[model samples]
Target: MEDVGLNQGQVFLSQNVLITPKKGDTYKSSRLSALDLQRGLIMCLMAFSHCRDYVSSVPNKNLSWNSPLIEQNISSLDFLQKSLISLVAAGGFYMMMGIGIFLLWQSRIKDGVNPKTIRNYLVCRGFVLVTVQFTVLALFETIAEGQFYLYVGVLFSLGICMMMAAWVMYGVELLKTKSWFGFSKIEYWLPLSLGLIIILFSHGVIWSNHHYNISPDVLQIALLLGGEYHTPMFFIDINFTPFPWFPSVALGLIIGKIVTTKKEKAWAPLCALAFIFLTIWFVIRTANIQGLFFFGDYKTISPNSAPLTWQSYMSISKFPPSLTYFLWSWSINLLGIVWWFKLEQIQPKLFTSFKALKIFGQNALFFFIGHWFIYYGLSIALPYHLTTLTGIITVWLIGLIILLPLCKRWYQFKSQKNKNSLWRMF
Candidate 1:
């Protein structure tokens, strides 16, 4: 939520001009409509993923749980759907966050906001996100699951990544002020450099724990660094870790900078870059080259389970996402951006026709919070599990239907000039 989209009272830019609207007012910026639509699409996919988790009877294990990947017990279609969602959903969200933050920063600069003031504001927002994750979200999950565990989830990770990005921005500013670096455009290289470093070193850092027998304190630190955590009483799994996700945010920042700075021509080069990355990803995955991390051969309990093929190659590690995972996921996101850009150009009305999805995109934080409660209530009242794809889609559509009005109402409330309550934090 920290980087989901515009804040409650923030005045965003439409093209290069600053539009100062009333507090909580929505700006009809067509340029950013594509982003909202993309976010909406991501939310739908996320709902489907959650539907599978709550409704499906199949036991879904982590793709990277064993030395070799385990062949999924699910049907081929289910496996494919889950695989794509697992790879792209979370990474896409983080990338969007990065893009959102950059846009926010650019808008603030256009409004003559001081750099320090902007940084402080972002820092506060980041802290609020982290707090909400541990408190509001944690409470919801505890109530739903009937268990009390400190779930450091996506919001927490996003908050931490925001703070990191803020520092990185500050560092870039400092470098620009100095003549020693001899580079005026350090911002262009910083995000990619930092992202590549994190991706390349993640596996080695995790491996060192096994060889050297890291202490509990050190292990806890490693867990924060995206290392696997498994304990009888407490587990800090990679899915919930923040470190591995930082790279996604970083990469997103790079794209965001390009979009905000380059304008219309950005998409062509970005699309080409994404295709190039996708090509490289295919080559590396097919050859089983360890550019960032090595994946083991897939093992299956049943002989009839899904075979190890290109699809299997596509099912890379996600918890601590490998380089290949980042490339594939971000490539899809970039291509989606290109596709949406073209669609928006050809038929803006057609692209914006899905009012419900655009609403969901605008009020993502509210929907995300509310949907969990909806799922929890449904799971309790229905007390039925659905195994087939049709059943899963049904449940997901039901969720969307249930959420649409709530999201719409909340969006209306949030858009009101007088409603400046803390509830707007969502």
Candidate 2:
């Protein structure tokens, strides 16, 4: 991250390189306030989406293969709203994780940490996350729904992505050590290349599920390959898989390299890059390109019964995020980063109003775990009706208001704990 400060309507980047803040004024941060804000906002959106899941009478048709069409026709505005809602939750979170990992890697390198040590940490962290996902998160879901099922969700995907990133880093380092190859630039493009290859083949991988006669146990592997599968015995539900989503993290690695390498006028080039992504997204989405494997057919107001309305177009599949879906979600998220950068440069004090969001953002892992328990407990204890959109929104707001303080306190407690303690994994 760039060292940014605002002094006399001028923005100073790292090394005291000063340029006039865009539009003549901006705020600044010792840490990356923009990232905190983006992460905070993503958490809030996720809370809303999850709350809707738990409480709304209408099942998320997007999640069901045999869902019926919604009686109420969706308008363009409604489609846009739904798109934004979906984008922030998973898409934003994964991309930010990528960015965060890259930043952490840079910090570790600067602190003289050995590659082996860093790799160990990454591997340990990934295993811890996977363990938590299956045990803690699955337990919470089972409790909330009063069912016994192993749910492989976002955390599982994230854990896999982390491990993959670590290995990619290790490969780059290995290549760097080889005198004959002399492929120094491999470190920069390795993640991006791997990500693109995975994405390009993702559609074919998922589609192959139909042709294979694999056993149920072996079929469960689809959970990691961007396809949803379940076992009768375990009742395992692979809702969010790692295959398609890992690319976001890879792209984030590329972006992180850019941010670190281009300290001066970094935001300018980033903003331009964001525009390019947005343009590609628009073209792919509007044209309904077929080779991209966009789930326009599945993303209807109801599943398998669509004339392909605007809502259908906007509500792209998330279980296995399509190429268009990735383009759309990531482009918007990139633009958001640019927006936050500009906002930080202009109105630093304005961030004070979002103190609770910042706290939640900073302590995301804690909040992610804690919020589920809180929501599940409330669902069991309270007899509140939350069938309507207004009711769902109310509950979501209440969760935020209550969880904000809890998250802040938890963050403070974690800070007081030993930095080297295993509990730091939260």
Candidate 3:
């Protein structure tokens, strides 16, 4: 569950900030109490992780398989605990992207928000997300990948998710309007079917081999529909299309229906589902199957060192969002959602201290893009060896603290500007 692409969800923390309404908005997307709480948790972790990333004194915590080049300085238990926290935050963030989309659809159905309005905003947002990342994130990747290149990540993932969510909502509406489905039926099964279809089609044999590359055109597929994975070296290939990933969006599509049900503590089940999914994925991944996603030299390094496992198998589906990927990512999302609800009663104040984290979650594209320049751009200005544990932690903590106020200011500006704008309708 490296989820490098999930950043597009702006869900690096949950997409709740993106989906939920600002107090200033004329059209409000009712806040998910869970999202706010979860969001706070997600943002805080982002900051903590970043801080841990840069500090000089502490040891690195190696948990999860994403890093083949490094091992954490921390002890095993510390790494495991930190890793689990990151997973909940990361997984919940993506699931929230799906939840946000689902809620938007429901809001349109029940409230005054027009489909055209939502569609237009998404179209515009999609463009922004892409351009921002290409400018910002691509630059960062160049540090490792060399030169500016397209990385179809979370911003890209979300742009694609938004576009797909629009179409899915449109189809849902069309079905309702045409009398092809009844209200009662639509409520229960439309979303359920959508979620199931996406999982089945994506995980099933029909779409299995359809992987693509990360490039400009390939990314466009992520926006318009779902996308398949391709070689990191190439941008497009036939095996790749925005197929299975659409299903993840579709699965998120179901989240809207579930939220709208107004059942007491309805959020609990989503959390439970996430927990169950993560537990299962963790168990299965222990067998080394999940590591299939690491289809590279990294796999040979051994799971103990490289963190490779069969759960890594979903690495392929990340673009189209393979079955294992969906279960793994979505399940974490579910748990985040469920946990937030419980956290809300206590209304933890620690969440706000990390409000700077939400700045990225809010207008993720800007922070994502901006951070790259700061991360790499500044490196050019203040050259240093980042390979050492101290250098990395120093950079991360300095970035988080400095960015806090900057992010807060941006959040205020964006929140105010978007309120009157038609963009708030979503």
Candidate 4:
């Protein structure tokens, strides 16, 4: 699992010192606890969105971020819930995924593990994720639809990005070994370059899809890249497309590399990045321009339908993730990382309260897949019981109560397994 991205023995900064725990040792660092707290909180809050989708009386399609804010049927509460859920989940998860990759690379490389072996393991783990997406995760959709509904959701896109990250790491290693001039900061430069280029490219593709009459062949390809798709083959939905979302992972890698190496010095620059991203989001939204790395201007919303306010304007496009969405999401995400780190040190008791829920974060992959089943199962068994937003949230709370102990057990089981164990794939 260390080679594939879940590295429990990762390096973290504690009290301005860099600490990499020994193999089979524990992390006493607040930074690690903060990360687990953040992840656990994300996983726990994410279930509310899922419960709303499966059990709420409102039609699921009407609950999407793209739906008109002025729609007569959608309650303001539901709209706010869905929008907030969409805002928080993926940006943090993908950033953590990138961080895991770098930490694994750093740990294994320090132990003198072969780079090729690490790359191969990453590729294998990625394919396993893809397989799980198509099989286990797809089972519910296929059975419900009565056809082969291939849904390319988060795990599928993550697997593709993981494979791509593997190759990128391999190339960095190759350059380090074979190049004439020594390249010291290749890791930082590479992912940063790739992330920016992909962001620009994805924005362009999405723009083109909106304005152009694309052929079916190109449209299918666009589906894999970052554009919305329409096809008659069964029923399909891609929650995340590989290319556009990969930037989050890339950005995480850059941050992880810096924090693990530069230690405390990383804090200033990270805070600055969060500020810059926030500024860009505000400027772009206010400017109301829709070209060259921006899309879905705030003013584009139908003015006659409803009174435009700050809240309405802030609810930007999420699916296929417009540049504004990425900027806004990651700005908050970056701030959270730094905020958590500081909070843990200044207020240990409060941090401990949150860290107690780290069971959900520690076993995030398991919790992610298991939660879908739990909520969906609840929907079937208790059909029509969850008619209100309160009931939906009640179900979400109950699901977390059930998942917490289960996640703890799973974490314990996973802990005993060797690095090569297949259980680590979760």
Candidate with the greatest TM-score versus the true structure: 4
User: Taking the tens digit of each residue's C-alpha lDDT, what string does model 4 give over 136-215?
Assistant: 98996786566777788888778888888888888888888866627578889989899888877766654565458454
* TM-score of candidate 2 on Cα atoms, chains taken together: 0.82
lDDT tens readout by residue for model 3, 176-252? 76644754456446656766775554333322332332233544343323433546564422221334445555565
RMSD of 1: 5.1
- lDDT-superior candidate, 2 or 4: 4
Candidate 2 vs 3: which has more lDDT = 2
Clashes of each: 0, 6, 41, 0
Q: Which model is ahead, 2 or 4, in terms of TM-score?
A: 4
Candidate 2 lDDT by residue in tens digits, 1-426: 111111122222223233455552233242355666677777777777666666654334353322332324654434444578675467777777777677667667667888777777777877877888999988877776556777888888888888888787767767878896484567567987988787767655544443373333444355543334445544666767776678887887777777767754668877887788778767766565333543332232323543544444455556666666677777777777777777656776775677676667777778888778766555555586475667667778888888987766665565555544455566
Candidate order by TM-score, decreasing, is 4, 1, 2, 3
When 1 and 4 are scored with lDDT, the better candidate is 4
Query: Comparing candidate 1 with candidate 3, which one achieves the higher TM-score?
Result: 1
Off by over 4 Å in 1: 2-28, 58-61, 65-67, 70-72, 180-183, 207-238, 289-307, 417-424
Q: Would you list the rank order by lDDT, best first? A: 4, 1, 2, 3
Candidate 1 vs 2: which has more lDDT: 1
Instruction: State the lDDT at 188 in candidate 4.
Output: 90
> TM-score, each model?
0.84, 0.82, 0.65, 0.85
Off by more than 4 A, model 4: 1-28, 58-74, 144-147, 178-184, 212-233, 289-308, 383-385
